[model samples]
Target chain A: MKKYKGYLIDLDGTMYKGTEKIEAASDFVKALAEKQIPYLFVTNNSSRTPEQVAEKLTEFDIPTTKDHIFTTSQATANFISGKKSNASVYVIGEEGIRDSIVEKGLQINDMNPEFVVIGIDREITYEKLSIACLAVRQGATFISTNGDIAIPTERGLLPGNGALTSVITVSTGVQPIFIGKPESIIMEQALKVVGTSLEDTLMVGDNYDTDIMAGMNTGLDTLLVHTGVTTVEMLQSIERKPTYTVGSLEEWIEKM
Target chain B: MKKYKGYLIDLDGTMYKGTEKIEAASDFVKALAEKQIPYLFVTNNSSRTPEQVAEKLTEFDIPTTKDHIFTTSQATANFISGKKSNASVYVIGEEGIRDSIVEKGLQINDMNPEFVVIGIDREITYEKLSIACLAVRQGATFISTNGDIAIPTERGLLPGNGALTSVITVSTGVQPIFIGKPESIIMEQALKVVGTSLEDTLMVGDNYDTDIMAGMNTGLDTLLVHTGVTTVEMLQSIERKPTYTVGSLEEWIEKM
Candidate 1:
């Protein structure tokens, strides 16, 4: 078996499931730390800051710092910064996206902005959507953190950012550039932050559509764990299989 | 030219355009009244009640009463009442839709509603959308008043009911039954209200997509005026043209 020099990990299903911690997650991180191998928790969650995500991981006994977390919000900020420095933006999201934009020195402007960014906004209002539609119609570049259609919760599957973004797209006839999982943009950014070559890095997750697809799009090997969304039976139905499949992280500890 | 027994007239582009009355519109309606020709103002606006719309028409010196106005709200109510008399519904809209549902003896219920109806609501909230999504996912029949993507105002085009409806559709992956112009449902109901036969009734409007398409779908003759959305150049591009294209309603008054 080939050994990877670095790893890109998923959060919700791979590291933990909601508030519950995965028993083998801490041990997997400890294995990487002992070998001095680089790894970053790549997440599509643009709602919380890296510090918040790191704190949650610490509670789960996972050895991760703020530097080990790379959220879609930071990727979006970096994506925009690469295009143009100090660009004006009209944002419809929570603290994490706002912090990332501010941290990258992007100006948050509602009227006549160069870009219109949408993330997960639980407090979304018609007025906010109206402004976004108007801005996009006025030729602002539309961008969304992720294209997640529905979010799972105790209540059930609620509307996600992609569903909310459809209002503007359907109204103004403009599709947004999604910057999160399954898209090569987020995976490429994660690779740069992890400081690893694509050939020597492995993208690991329990999901097939987002995580494995992200790895495939970024020219990296992918390891699909069965501890989360995609089961072995489900993977068999898919035409393109991931590079590796395992029941849990414990099965891959020997290779690490 | 064939003389029509009744007319289904569009409001925004035909009778008036955003608070300003067309010069030929009042004269055309007066000609209809003098000849005792039956005509109903057919509008896709689900936000305003018939009484309110009638009042506005009266202000513009157009001969109209609440009985002469046929809005999409009333058509939706009629459609639901025909399906199941006094059926329970979960609605998202202003007073217009609520009043119509109640007038038709339909019950307004959020918990386990038989139908999930969407109309234009300026006070739309995430909670309201969440409930609608949940109800739709729970096997409730979803319905939308119109599929008009944008509403033209003095401030420019704003997000319409169709845009707001996309949120629930995208989240739940359920296509809603649209009951407005271009859908034929409202046109069928308007024919009943106008007491006109399909062969004798003429659908008149300025928009080619909505008014003309509705007429074509319902197997009625259509008259396209040049005062609103469709232009002579635009009409030339369409493969299926209106039965009669005129520069103004005054040209059609002689035939009436």
Candidate 2:
């Protein structure tokens, strides 16, 4: 196996399966830490701040700090900043996205914004949607953190940011620029954050659709683990297979 | 001109535009009243009760009663009642839909309902959407009052029932049975309510997409009036034309 200089890894399914730690995943990260391999956890979850995600990883015995996380929220903020620094944004999201946008020195304006950014917001309301629709109709650049239609929960799949974003999209007849995995924008942002050249970096995740596709979309080699989401049967149906497939993260630890 | 035994007319664009009453529309309805031509106002608005709509029409001097109005909420209730009497439903809408369901003896149940119905709600919340998505994922038959993506308001075109419905539809990957204009289900229910045969009834409206398409879908002759949404240029683009076209209701009043 060719050794990559840096790694961009997915959280949730790849690292752990929703609060339950994957022991092999912990060992894999520990091995990377031991080998001094630079790695960053890239996630589509825009509701959680880097500290919260790092804390979660720490609980799972995976060595991680706030700087080791690249959230979609951060990517989204950086994306807007790149386009136009100090851009006025009307944001619909939880603390993560809000914090990211604020930290980036962007103006938060509801009346007339330069951009309308949507992330997963549990406290989503019709009024917020109305404001977003109005802003979009007024020619604001629409952007969504991710296009995850459903979020997996204990009860069942709940409505995700993509579904919520549809209200503004369907109403205003405006399509949002989605920045999460599977879309090349987030991958490019993650690559820049990790300071890795595309050819020398490996994108690792358990999901074929998001993680693996993100890697492929950004022209990076991908390693798909079977710890979560995509099963071997599900993977077989896909036309373009991941560069590497492993039964567990333990199998990929040797390469690090 | 071929005289029709009954008329299924649209509100908003046809009778009035927002709060402004169409002067010629009042005369047309008066002519229908004088001729004793049975007419029912079929509306896609599931937020207003039949009584409320009738009251509005009365204010405009467009001879109407509670019995002469058939809202999508009532149509939705009738549609559900036809399938299973007193069926439990998880509703995500306003008082109009709520009242219609209860009045029809149907139960409003949030947990494990037989059906999930969506209508326009200005006070839409994430919790309501979550419940609807959960219900739909649990195998509930999903239904939307209408598929009108944008609702015309003084501010501008706001998110409509169809746009709100996309949350559950996109999240659950379930396409709802839309029970409004352009759907034969609502038209069939309206036909039964007005006691009119499809061949003998004439549908009149200003919007070609909803009213004209509804009539066309139900095999009813449609009269397109150029007072509201669908303009002459828009009508020319459509492959299937309305049976009759007029500049105003005053032109149709002569035929009556």
Top lDDT prediction, candidate number: 1
DockQ top scorer: 2
What DockQ does model 1 achieve?
A: 0.79
* lDDT (tens digit, per residue) of candidate 1 on B29-111: 99999999999999999999999999999999999999999999999999999999989999999989999999999999999
Q: In model 2, where do residues sit more than 4 Å from their true spots?
A: none
Instruction: Mark the regions of model 1 whose C-alpha exceeds 4 Å error after superposition.
Output: none
Assign candidate 2 its CAPRI class. Answer: high
A1-256, model 2: which lDDT tens digit per residue?
7999889999988888886878898898888888887899999999999999999999999999999999999999999999999999999999999999999999999989999999999998888888899999999999999999999988788999999999989888899999999999988988888897989999999989899999999999999999899999998889999999999888777777
TM-score of chain B as predicted in candidate 2? 0.98
Q: What's the TM-score of chain A alone for every prediction?
A: 0.99, 0.98
Instruction: List clashing residue pairs in candidate 1.
Output: none
**DockQ for all models:** 0.79, 0.84
* Candidate 1: residue A147 lDDT (0-100): 87
True lDDT of residue A216, candidate 1: 97
Q: Which window of ten consecutive residues has the lowest lDDT sum in model 1 chain A?
A: A149-158
Q: Worst 10-residue stretch by lDDT in candidate 1 chain B?
A: B149-158
